[model samples]
Target: MTDFLRRKLIQAAGSAAALGPFAIGSVSAQQKGDIVIAASQPITGIFAFAGTAMNNGLNDFVLWKNANGGVAGRKLRYVSEDSGFKLDQGVAIFKKLMASEKPSFFYGDSTQWAKAVAQDAVAAGTIMTSSTSLASSMADPTGMPQHFVPGPIYGSMHEILMEYIAKTWSKSDKPKIAYVYADTEFGRDGIPAGKARAEKLGLPIVTEIVTKQAGIDVAPEVAKLRRARPDIVIFQGYILAPMPEFVRQMREAGLQSQVMGTAWGLDKPAYDALGAMGESLAGVSPYRYGHETDSTMINAMRDFGAKNRPDMKNISPFYISSWLSGMVFAEVADRCIKANKPLTLPNMKAALESMKEWDSGGIFGTLVDLSKHQAPVGRIYRYEPKTKTMEPASSWLKV
Candidate 1:
């Protein structure tokens, strides 16, 4: 954090000590210092908006964490490469960084990168990894033991939405749900699991719509959806391009079906681009929005952006996701250091898993548990265009 932000925080909290557990501490360095957190971030390409924000969030967190006592007396040092959101490029960056930096924690760009580097990370044995992905497959402790998700898996997100639909449906017949996703790995990842969850709840999957990454016509897709007339439609594997058009066209077709999305889709840009129709979009979110007051951590994030990134608007969900990853990294390293254990993969993995009812100081409204490699709590939120915020539509749910 900048000096101005630190001074402002202290003043806001009344005293240095009044800032509580997350308050800044003496900048004195320990003998064994500089815990490295490296990343192959997608700062370019399709996910640039999210990637740029995520990188900024992590960088700011490192600064803030160092100012706040440096995690067991060791200051954080962050290094990153812009992977351009390409899998091969990301993997190569991971290799180069691992060899050069020997970081204790590494954040990946995508599920492909996470999977590509998992075995190598395990072989390194000195690092644990995390990413923006909530792919259910990444949650396996045995298969991807050294990797952890910052939130619930995508399947769990779909199930959470289904649960909400089931509980709120007032008709005699079960509500019809449709899954509209892209053909990318991320787009197809959760469909099977989501279908299973819906079947388990006795709800019907009326239709499943698939789209390509680009150059696809939505008229046919909308016509197909109009025919299905699903009571609810859940979108996956996209940031913005087609969703706003789909929502608009669907509305024009005189369909009143509610639209929903998962984590990445809930970012501010996606909602803001939807204009007046944004209010109709609702979905599951694992992290608190930066503007929300309940989380001290979130408030601090906003303060950092305000003092540092003056031109930046509201903090995006991707920013919170990466910020949470930094926190998790620090917590794991802190645990290992306090116990006099080496910051090896096994040690960090154990430290990560042992965190039951872990308080992220406010990122999560509910206490977090990473034992399953996933923080299985999420809340339903609908965008309120009037306020330009995603207001909570339901209480927190753990699946």
Candidate 2:
């Protein structure tokens, strides 16, 4: 990593009161408090693009909240360490925080880490967690009571994309569609359900291509897409690579398919990297972006970024997800405290379940209903490369 990036990460691990946890990586936090919100963040590795932003976003929110008199007058402490996006390291960090920090709420790195640690978390019943992964399985409040997905499940994101496509079909024939995804769990987990939704909408899925998440060779994939000539090509589980190359090659092959993606593959940076290729790129997002004034949370985020992180022009969607996680944590904690309950597993779990039609300060344009443990909502956005902004393409979808 560049020296500047390294420094920023160390700062993200900044401590709150006393020296932070040392066994994990450098730990940065916000405020000094008893209600600990610890995290096993993916600060380095293939996912750093999103993970680092997550660290900053959560830490920043904690700082912001502490400035606003904290929950129930109890201070909130935010502690976190970089797990380098590794499952083993993330699990270790989780264990360390649960043991040493004795936190009331936690943020984990991925769907894998959340599933791996759920049994332990539920057994402890003293803490609750939110993760970057939006796996549908984690949304089951009955099965994974201790873990909650921060946004829409992987399948619901796909289903929302299908809804957008179905509504926008101006062609004489039903739009022929192609689904391209990586071979990872995040990639393939949602395809079956998404395909089912598309079938229900009577949209013809012409092809499904599975490939590596990031690699140099996409010619073979593009060759298949070329042959299919579907009107829509939707991507999932990819961060940056392959999508740009695939789009470039498809255009070179003289095809005119509309390219779209789920949340992961369509971050602002991905589009910024794509430059002109992203001009035609439209994707679904669970949270509102920073370019608009419609959302109270989005506006606050924009002002906060300008003042605190001036170098970062566009706040990341992953960061918004992290901030949303912090919101949920604080909300649960506040509810528990107000109810004169301890921050135990059952109490906090009950507090979380009680959330219905909660206003997220406009983070979500619509009132959030997390009764199912995942927010199955999204809005379609088209990239405006000239302005480096994500402009809305469709209304908010609560699927």
Candidate 3:
């Protein structure tokens, strides 16, 4: 991680710790006067960049809420641990937090971790959970009532991208599609649905390539893609590193296929990494970028950063995603309070599921509905190397 990001993370940790528990020894049973919010984040691993941004956003939101007298007159006590983006570590952190903090709300690091602890979370009966993951499996209301997402599931996002590809394809041309993903739960989560959606749209999926999340050499995968001669290739389960390398290698190999990515692959960092090669890149995003000053939520967050974190210059999409997730939690807590309901897991679940047309202050372009526990809305964006930013390629599509 960069020195700037490291310092920002340290500052965020200190600020959150000041308002709540920082260690297991400092935490006791949940107090009636405090609302504990615990999380497991990938603060020091393959996803450190994203995890640090997410942690910063979550801490900023918690601190902002506390400064504003908190929700329902109850101060939110934020606590978190690093999971290193490892499922075992994530599960262990969840168990430790539950036992030590007895938190009412939990933020998970990955979909695998959320799935691992879903039954336990339900059995616990009082704790509600959200995650960085937008896996379709986590949206099950009957089985995972206490778990929710801030945006559309990976499958839904994949479908939206597929629909875009289909709509844009010429009637006389049959576009060949390729799927490249990492060998992780996140990398593979959307494949089945993406394949089905492609079949339904009559887009022929020519190949599927599996690569490491942080692969250094993608020549082999690029070779496969070159041979397949896909019209478009979609990447999944990567944040910054490997995808750019893949794109660079593909370009060097004279591959003409247009590259698209899912949420994880759609960010400024990726564009910055791709450099001039990113001009042809396009992807889908659940929320607007931090540089998108037109958004009320982005403007508000920028103002917050100027006042509180003057040293930080750029806010990435990962940060906005985490901040929006915090907003969702706060909104649900406020709703439960207004309804005169106890702030328990079940009440929180009800409040989340009941959300409809909830304005996110332009965090999401349209009103949010959580009837399915996922925001079924997103937009396509193409990266512009000349401007070094992602420009909207399509209006928000509701899937």
Candidate 1, 190-222: lDDT as tens digits:
788778888988989999999997777899999
**What lDDT score belongs to each candidate, Candidate 1 first?**
0.83, 0.80, 0.81
Angstrom error at residue 191, model 3: 1.6
Better of 1 and 3 by lDDT: 1
Q: Model 2 lDDT vs. the true structure? A: 0.80
Q: Estimate the TM-score for candidate 2.
A: 0.89
Which sections of candidate 3 miss by over 4 Å?
A: 1-32, 86-89, 214-217
lDDT (tens digit, per residue) of candidate 2 on 1-399: 235434432332232112322222222222224689999888889778788989999998888888889898977889999999899999999999888888888998888898888766766656789988887787987667777888888888889988888889964688899999889888887888889999999999999999986655888888998899999898887887778878888889988898888887778657876766544678888888867898888788888888899998777888899999999999998996686555656667678889988889887788878888888888999887667777899888978
Cα-based lDDT at residue 399, candidate 1: 81
- Residue 287 of model 3 has an lDDT of 88
lDDT: which candidate is best? 1
- Between prediction 2 and prediction 3, the one with superior TM-score is 2
lDDT of 3 by residue, 78-185 (tens): 899999999999999999988887787889888788888876776665577888888888888766777888899999899899999888889689799999988988
